[model samples]
Target: MHACARVGLDFLDSAPYRIVSTVDLAITPAQLFEVLADENSWPRWATVITKVTWTSPPPRGVGTTRTVTMRGGIAGNEEFLAWDPFERMAFRFNEVSTSSMAAFAEDYRVVPTSRGCHLTWTMALQPANLAGRIGLSLGAPVMNRLFQRFLHNLRRYTDERFSAQ
Candidate 1:
């Protein structure tokens, strides 16, 4: 098991929280998973993820590290904790010196449905300090709205890509 699973449970007890964004796409779970698992394609599909670069070498699976720049120039480093093709994947913010969150975990899952597939993105975050905690509490709604947009963007991108084929 990754160290992340063992740490932060007690630290986050006061602020245990999770934000989830989900979408149903008219595409196979495998197809959607491919797009998500390909880190380089993030900027093309998810506008919020403005840029991505592997800090370490690839065949991107568990333990791969990458730096991601978000919409407003917020850069963070991520480490893949779990990778399960066509089913689910999970990652954590690992080494972003500027990030205010002490611990952040994101898990993405793609589940097959009768028509297509349901994709869910879930994030767990704990601020680094007391002030950071207050800020997150206040801005949670805005953050949630943005996450929804990210999910919708994924759906739009996947649909357009597959339609053109």
Candidate 2:
């Protein structure tokens, strides 16, 4: 994997390309966090993700590391920037299999709601070159829809999971 430019929390706010997707889940924030913490749960909800392996041990928190394998064999080495359990979790890729990205990060925020919880997922990226920029720009619309679909998948997965238990 090639090293990606290290990005800070500020990048989530300032990245040139960002997609924010929100969904309301009929589960508490803790339940949502449980899904986030379970590596096996990722592939079940986020279709683009194939696997997740925690590089760091238990008690996940800031600076914890993980490797995520996505579709198309793309892999990312990530480090957590914020881990507030049920409320917020964010991470940035320290390295990636592709050269098209200068940086990439994601922020997941959960807020309690009357129904259950509201999740706002934000994906931020900086393209490495003109080709990358053009590709992202052209694919933005489809990507946005795909992201929202992932959240809907999450909602269904969680609903089935909790109801079964």
Candidate 3:
């Protein structure tokens, strides 16, 4: 078992905390991307995404950019790190107002499975300092749960919305 599992952790979230979970779903990449790209669809799928006001024109190709605001900060910018059309997209979170203990990178990859699409989302944090490491030890549970909840909702939305398409 991995160190996290040995400690009774099923998974780790990326934001300096590695909490992980595996979800099975039945959805297509195009259908998933349609929802993932629309800023309005965030609240419908992601639990922590309270707001997403587009900072630029909606992007259809790779390298598209958007200033996506999330719930953890006063203002959030979600820069598109990678966008493979209906395949995959990645972005990092930058707080415009609030200063977090750890910064994070989010990678959302959509893999086409025979049954459906497999989404792999990863969030990691930048070690702030020694104190930050200690904070991670304590905050991992909350952060892990938050990420899991987000993924869980995403899976549900994708399965329900996309599978019907």
Candidate 4:
């Protein structure tokens, strides 16, 4: 894998391309965070993700690392920038299978609501070259919709998961 640019929390706000998706789930923040922390839970909701493996040992916190494999065999080595339990978690890719990404980061924030919890997911990226830039620009809209669908999937998965217990 090629090394990607290291990015900080600020990149979540300043990246050239960003997609923010939100969903209100009928689950508590703790339940949502539990799903986020479970490696097996990823592919259940994020259809594009194939696997997630923790590269760092427990207790997960800032600087923890993981490897995520997506559809099409795209893989990313990620380092957590923030890991406030039950509230916020964010990470950035340190290396990726492809060279088209100069930088990539994602932030997930959960807020308690009257009914359950509301999640805001932000994906930020900087293209490595002109080809990458054009591709992302054209695909941004579709990507946003897909991400939103992932959250909806999460809601359904969690409802079924928790309801069965």
Candidate 5:
């Protein structure tokens, strides 16, 4: 699936649409980078991310590849695209195969700013056939909601961690 975690499900309304979201948080790039580096720990921050079985080690860097599973039963392989620690983090995936499930690619990016950082996770999917078109179209708003939730959860996670230190 293009979307990792699932979000709001009020999709009986919209027909054809695309999901695009951008969120900024007030936290050190170092802190944000640490969170992004650990794929297994994703579920801890994203409420919808119930699972993340890592095929790599902590602080994943350039050329690293790992599988990402979400609470909504969505799973995909993520490959590191850019791994500039404390400054940027990005990844791409062409597919995520499973014993019984569909596979797709997802691109993730984290860019540092003067105050804190900006994290963007995006997916581009072209339906296999006209039959799948309805899904991609209806998925836009739902995915956008999931993206918003991710940002909300990320902010909470950062706040809790930084507060404890």
Candidate 6:
């Protein structure tokens, strides 16, 4: 059986789509976790994330709200679902503007490696409709590449910033 099927994801509407990107960086898990936890600095390191503004109180934790604007004018109203410092952080977004998917959840995990740490990002998406499913199928490759760029950007930003410190 397919892994997606084993996960109990639906066929068309909730057709489970996951994008996972991993990068090994020469930084401690705590250092990488601090960067990942700071949503305000995302735009600086992530090309697709153009802007992020907190919609809830300070100190990002579970239930925190944030408005994120990505490249090409795509925006999403997101809320923090889980926040585990130096380990993982997860979020769900809805009420997207100028996007195909209706809602999606993303999680980032930082694991300690012998050299430094390995950061992995996982995102599962749900299509809004039939048309959205078609769009997801067709756009999956491009989205994967976009996320690859995001991982590259994270690595570059961390290298440049931490190496200078």
Highest lDDT model number: 2
Q: 25-128, model 4: which lDDT tens digit per residue? A: 88899999899999999999999999999999999999999999999989999999999998999999999999999999999999999999999999999999
Higher TM-score: candidate 1 or 2? 2
Choose 1 or 4, whichever is better by TM-score: 4
Going through the candidates in order, what is the number of backbone clashes in each?
Answer: 0, 0, 13, 0, 0, 0
Cα lDDT tens digits, model 3, 1-165, are 001111111112424465554455676777777887777889787756677776767545544546555565555554565678666666655444544334545666777899877777766555446776888788888877877787788877776776655
Q: How far in Å is the alpha carbon of 78 misplaced in model 5?
A: 2.6
Which residue ranges in model 2 land beyond 4 Å of their true spot? Answer: none
What is the lDDT of every predicted structure here?
0.75, 0.97, 0.62, 0.96, 0.60, 0.75
TM-score of each: 0.84, 0.99, 0.75, 0.98, 0.71, 0.84
Q: Please identify model 5 stretches exceeding 4 Å from their true place.
A: 1-18, 57-59, 98-104
How much does each candidate deviate from the true structure in C-alpha RMSD?
A: 3.9, 0.6, 7.8, 0.7, 7.2, 5.9
lDDT (10s digit) by residue, model 5, range 1-165: 343322112221121333445678788778877777665558876776666665777657766777776654666676665677776555544354433222233444567788677876554444445556776566667777877887788888887777766
Instruction: Quote the positional error of residue 93 for candidate 2 in Å.
Output: 0.3
Report RMSD for candidate 2: 0.6
Model 3 scores worst on lDDT over the 10 consecutive residues at 1-10
- Worst lDDT 10-window in candidate 2: 1-10
Q: What's the best-to-worst order under lDDT? A: 2, 4, 1, 6, 3, 5
Candidate 2 clash pair list: none
Tens digit of per-residue lDDT, candidate 1, span 108-147: 8789999899988888877777887898889889989988
Candidate 1 runs further than 4 Å off: 1-15
| lDDT for residue 91 in candidate 3, whole number 0-100 | 60
Model 1 residue 153 CA deviation in Å: 1.2
Per-residue lDDT of 122 in model 1: 80
